[model samples]
Target: MKYRIIELSVLIIAVISVYAGLSYARQAAGGQTIQKGGLVADVRAKKIGDIVTILINENARASNNNATQTNKQNQLEATGDFGNSFLNNLSGGVSAQTQNQYRGSGQVSTSGTFTMQITASIIKVKEDGNFIIRGSREVETNGEKVVTVVEGVIRPGDISRDNTISSSKIADARIFHQGTGVSTQAHRPGLFTRILNWIF
Candidate 1:
């Protein structure tokens, strides 16, 4: 009976020691929370009011051309002779010739390209883990100003570790670019020219 009691006591002591060691280890770990995939959680721009870097490597090109031409020509000739008579001799045979021509041509061409970069901030976060961002940038030099604005939605997964995303990846995007200054004014027609064009 004593031998059995000794075995029971030793088993209880071993279990208690193991439990105490496990509890101490847990406490020593500082109660760190583990992510679903065992990855250390990071504070990324996944919420509203978060600032994100937008690597605006954007480029666009457009071109158009139109041409038209027309040409027309017409000619007519007629000659008449009266029956042999004195009247016919007095009034020489009648002759007539007529000609008409018309020509027209027109052409137009246009093309443009743009590239720029800007940073943006998150304005809202959707239930599906998407972010809505809006931002603008302006550059001025020598009295000339250029403004660029962008607004759109983006998926969190699209953002890189550095919290940057390409403008092309944005969804439902609205982008605008405008310029104003002496250079822009020089490209436009004068007031009188514009008035003439409108009148015509």
Candidate 2:
């Protein structure tokens, strides 16, 4: 009986100690404990290892054009010659004209658009309340492989209640998309075309 009493007393003491420690920690952190939901989990990324879903919707376009023109002309004329050389009854006149012109024009235009969705990992947290995130994904279909990489800084307020943020809100963002394989090569220029392009 005495041994049972000792064991029970020890268990009680441990429980009380745990409760006190938890309460103190909660007060220090200014957080509330939800008994039903276990704990009120933060929906926002706060520290390293916390992940934020990134809604990636981006578009890009580029166009270029050039033109050049050149023109030149020259003329010469003379009169009242041979008045003193021959019989004075004959008149001489000379006229000459020269002209040169050049014209050149060129135009080139290109545009592209891309859209994707990716989940990023929070790699760092700054003192200024910024989260540095990096993410990458690769997909292969029909013998063609595509790779995408993204990294950037984000603010906590930009994160939605569902722990998602738009790619547009990311600052200093770097996103790269590339592909390889038969399909990619098919879309690219052939060997002859590439040779011509290199020569030009």
Q: Pick the candidate with the highest lDDT.
A: 2
List candidate 1 segments past 4 Å from native: 1-43, 62-115, 187-200
How many residue-pair clashes does candidate 1 contain?
0
CA lDDT of each candidate? 0.69, 0.74
- Model 1 TM-score relative to the real fold: 0.47
Q: Against the true structure, candidate 1 has what lDDT?
A: 0.69
Candidate 1 residue-wise lDDT, 66-86, digit = tens: 333323333444446567755
- Displacement of the residue 12 alpha carbon in candidate 2, Å: 38
Worst 10 residues of 1 by lDDT: 101-110
**What is the overall TM-score of model 2 with all chains considered together?**
0.47
lDDT of 2 at 74: 60
Best-matching candidate per TM-score: 2
